[model samples]
Target: MGAATPSAQGPRILGSRGSGSSPATGPEAPGSPLTASPGGRMGLPGAEILVGLVAGIDVNMPCLGFALVAKDLEAARDVLRVCERLGIELSEPFYTRKGLCVTAVVELPWYENPVHFLRRRVEGYLRYMLPDVRRVRRVWGRLVWKRVRLPAAEADVLMPLVERLLREYGMPGLKLPATVAEDLEELVYEWGRRWRRSYDWAFKVATGRIFRAVSRLSRRHVVLVKLEDLRGIKRKEKWVPVIRRWPWTRLLRLTLGCTPPWVGVALVNPRGTSSDCPACGGELKEHSYRELVCESCGRKWHRDAAGAANVAFAKPVEYLRFPASSPMNPKKPGGGEDGGNEETQRTSRLVDKDPQPRAPRDGSRPVAGVEHTRQRGPIEGLTLTRPQTLPPGFPASKG
Candidate 1:
């Protein structure tokens, strides 16, 4: 779902949570009065429970990095409670992995240009992030292909069905309280304030703005926890020792909840795998860049076609041809002029001893009785023939 309005660049607001300054502003403020309470015990119900799909979108350009863990009604509500405590913005329901899915979109703002921002952010999250754009595109393409494979178009029309389901589930027109903006501002300030000792004011402000904007615009409930904050808590508290303790275990039981069994994890980019030839279990090195040549058999195909074929589950047809001979070497024991001479001797041994008539080399019709020329004529008979001629009008003078 979309946010109420586009984020505006303004001075840092210290402790604001919603749109309006009033505490009685957003969706959760009414049910839980402490939602607007300054420092009282604030309690909210847990989120809805359903199968979850955790999708991480790492944008390279503009360096926007977002992670979404989407669950059904129960889990979503619990997540919302957590987000509310932190003063993050919550949006209305939207379609996602399944029909009528409620999502929380977390926006990440990068101060630098898109390219530089993405590179740096991605390097930080490399373990969780996919490498190439093609991998991300492929994941989406697979989803589309699944729909195309469906027998009926209606069976695969996910978006429309989700919209209908959401309407039926009483999820339309859900709005955020005005005070959420203020709380969001406070949370962002705290996040940035912690880093103020090490970072400049500009960095803190810019980062704070990004955190708030992301919390608000997220499709589902978004929790904007700084990476540094998490790391700091882990270092000081030592999570392993605390997890084993009694009261902390019960108090933070929600965090220990196991994910649903049906949740699927899809790897965006598998390492050392060729995107083109997924079927034949062949690699790009099997062929040149432009042509796909098989090393096993002398089969050749266009590189693109080979890639497509690799994806398709098909048996390869073999064509027989002469095998290429290896180059002969004179120095090698079995290769060289000596080997050729041996082969010629062997061939001669295979022939009969009887003399046979040989053909003329000049290509003239052979005279049946005459022998072919074998030697040159003597030098004494090599004189040139003189031309015979008559005087001008000699016949008339004789008459």
Candidate 2:
């Protein structure tokens, strides 16, 4: 590996040593299409792409961090460092295994549930159709259910009102029933089911946009994602339902479903991708909001990008079950219930042979410059009014 040479600015660019050549011409260089795409006519065969999934800063906000890097571990670190210093996007097109100039054209805010609208209409319809029924109590912003029950005669009279409500709030292209059912409760439940199904469809469409952009980038390489089960994650010594805070599993399923048959999907252990330094396998300490510094190498990295790069090369500790022989199934042939894929497993074995640097050869500590010395910790009580966008080069997400 080469040593980092800093320009007049703070970020270091990988020169001709650690990477075997300058990144501009190197085979694993992310900037070069010849090497970056990997496995096409000009790319090296059997290369894998990395993606780091970071949850959003706020619980109410529907966003996740998707930083990426696809190159030599050292080179990826350098590129990520450069991106931070230059104020460029955190994820490069190369990390996505997509060619340069690929663009995402999908519309955003994939899921828009009409359950709330239906709830509101039901309240009004009850007042107009059955004056005897009064909302005697409100629980957590919803009208008490027993008060809204209707007699069979009232249900029949409300059929026309229910039909009009469905027409008003129903999504376009959805098939409407020939006539409203005699049971108002059944009709309400049916509308809820229809909306839920439509939500799943919209989620697929949003993910499809991301896949189309990735496919346009490159047609050859498989996308390897580092997924961690964060449903039971702990925060500040308190148990929190992280999945309810954000749809972590939903995003994973959407990614698997949208991927084309030609491209492969592999799930790797997310364990230390964000905490370990990709360059030296050293532990990383938080340096700032969403940034990290390697304790051993003393280099700064954007948390998301460094994690994504490490994911590309991280080994899977356990078998991740998915559909067999599908593009989303990363399991090797004949591995059956326990087999692992070749790309990440092979790379981890190769990396083990190299001597991991425990300390910088230069006999200097990581520069405690103004940038590195800042306070490092999580933001508390942060909230956003609107969904945040993914780092440039991918789809605009509002999941």
Candidate 3:
């Protein structure tokens, strides 16, 4: 009876903060991780859904947004719709002016983890880099006025130690998360001009971190990023949302591509993501398909995909690995429904099981680990690219 009481009260006790020291947690620590990988995704009728959604962020800020493309048209549309809806919900807080004061937690439903990451990011390694560069500039730029660019060399020397300290000096067994990868990628934008090597190193580090993050999740991750501008959007509205102008998907892909061949990394088509309502099969007629209006049900939803389309299903696979007790993932090593191990392995290796390098190189920069430099994929269903070499101490990405 006594033991049961303590056990019963255990949850409450822990919740009360009277326990021993706990790991530091940010605003997103308590939300479900299901919102990040496949669990956060929506399903299309038949085609394989890539980036089923693209959500805009911070309406108050300059219109920087994200896109989800799967390289496949039908699949991309499904992903885009979800992203569009999420973008509106998130932007609402800012629109109502509530987000300015941290009045409510609006991001927990879909992208909780990313929201938390943005909060924790203010104190990352990036903060230290620029100030150091500035201090050096304050003294150096004055000493040599336009004779030669010496700050680059000086920055190289002063920066590496700080970078090393950040990566190595942390407590043993503490692993950085994918959010830090975003921070590292952002560092490139801030410092890339002054220190090119540092930017490269930061990008390399971010890719490695993201590779590990994408790997641990289920193998069916289809990385949907904005690829190309299919057509110019004709907006009739007096004012367009700021995010419509942002290329959120592009930044995500370029950063992850620094390492190459990450599983689930691909460009998803942005058409039809949010044109027709997933709830109702009605054509959306409002704000260039930005806002989805289901005339049949009258339930309106904000659309996010760049364009429109239809879909169909493919065969399922065998030998699937599901969660330990998840209903879908059987504990037993059951055979796949259609093709057996060979076919399953091939598809899984490209996504859920393998690393998808970002879409094929445009022949501008050389892709590392690509044996035969013949580049003709991305459009014709090539998801896995060559893996790049990782620096020492960086974990090798799983195939």
Candidate 4:
């Protein structure tokens, strides 16, 4: 742990929510055209590009918008036809100056307490020694090695110099043990990136969100599919004020403008992608560890995969009917004649819950207070839309 993300000093564009909120809804009609979707304003008719809106979060892997390849407008849906490897999974959750920033946890460290302490001590010193907010702000904002964060950068610059200066002072015990030195360095750099991104997510009224979405979409030439916010699904998930304020769809368009002129953005109404079963129209049973057990057919599904599938392949029927006989929705608790409910929970990505620290991705508790890193990598999920032209102003012209 290099430095914990401090909401006050870091960024906080949006807020966070509780669990089991909106649980999940099923997918819409398979291959149906999506017009005026919530995620983004771009209209995806389902034939032009291989668009797979992200629906849920995997305990092990976080996903963002997934991609598939397609040249013309009438491409076929190949579930496996994705970009090199990208999707719309959020980063680790942290409060930003403006709102919530969702990032992924690439690595975890055990010394969270120490890292936080270091961050506070150093930041305090910076604030005091360098009284000017502008200068202190500059140091904190500068990317570490143009890659990592503050503590990581500071550690790299200071550790050796401090050790050298103190070599004759008999303070050898202050040096970080060689065993944890390597891991600590990596952790700091990573935290720097993660912590700063929280601010980036909310900075400039969501300029960072737009930049990230567009950059990723442009690089892959993939269509940016916007899904509804998952907040509206259930009351259990406390409504996040910042989430309501953030214009994710607008960010998608801004990202589109930044993309190569050819890459496109699209939207999909991701209603009921989480609750209804795709294998059969059966009500899905919520499972621990983020899975859905189909009550009608007794099939088990990973929550993220199922939700992504629904995002991509839900039915054409505008209205969804809950099984009247099911115990969870007995008498169709949220169902009606045309759809389940008029005020149905039409929320967005199950990319997942609160801003709090998450358990290890593998679902195992830390044994002896030690957590092992997973060996897996991010998934190359469904989509296809490659950029034909590089955006303008690449490799800034040297005078």
List the global CA lDDT of all models: 0.31, 0.41, 0.32, 0.37
CA RMSD of all predictions: 37.5, 26.0, 27.8, 26.0
**Reference-based lDDT, residue 39, model 2:** 15
TM-score of model 1 vs. true structure: 0.18
TM-score of each: 0.18, 0.34, 0.24, 0.29
- Deviating ranges (above 4 Å) for candidate 1: 1-55, 61-71, 95-110, 114-266, 269-399
Which of the two candidates, 1 or 2, achieves a greater TM-score against the reference?
A: 2
Model 2 clash pairs? 1-17, 1-18, 2-17, 2-18, 98-217, 99-217
Per-residue accuracy of model 3 over 1-399 as CA lDDT, tens digit each: 122332222112112333333343531134422111122121121212223222111111112222222333443344434434433222211111111100111211121222222223333553554445344543543332211111221233334443454355441122223344345545534443433343334434433433332232213333322222222432444434333433344344453453223222222334454455433456666744345566775755444321211111111111011112111112214323223455455544555633544543554543667643345546575466655776789886686
Instruction: lDDT for model 1, please.
Output: 0.31
The sequence of per-residue lDDT tens digits that candidate 4 reaches over residues 92-199 is 222322122232212121223333534654444433422342334445434232221234534544444434433533333334333333444565566667744543
Best by TM-score, which number? Answer: 2
> Clash number for model 3?
36
How would the candidate models be sorted by TM-score, starting from the highest? Answer: 2, 4, 3, 1
lDDT of 2 at 172: 21
- Writing each residue's lDDT as its tens digit, candidate 1 over 154-177 gives 222323433343244333222112
Using TM-score as the yardstick, the better of models 1 and 3 is: 3
Clashes of each: 39, 6, 36, 62
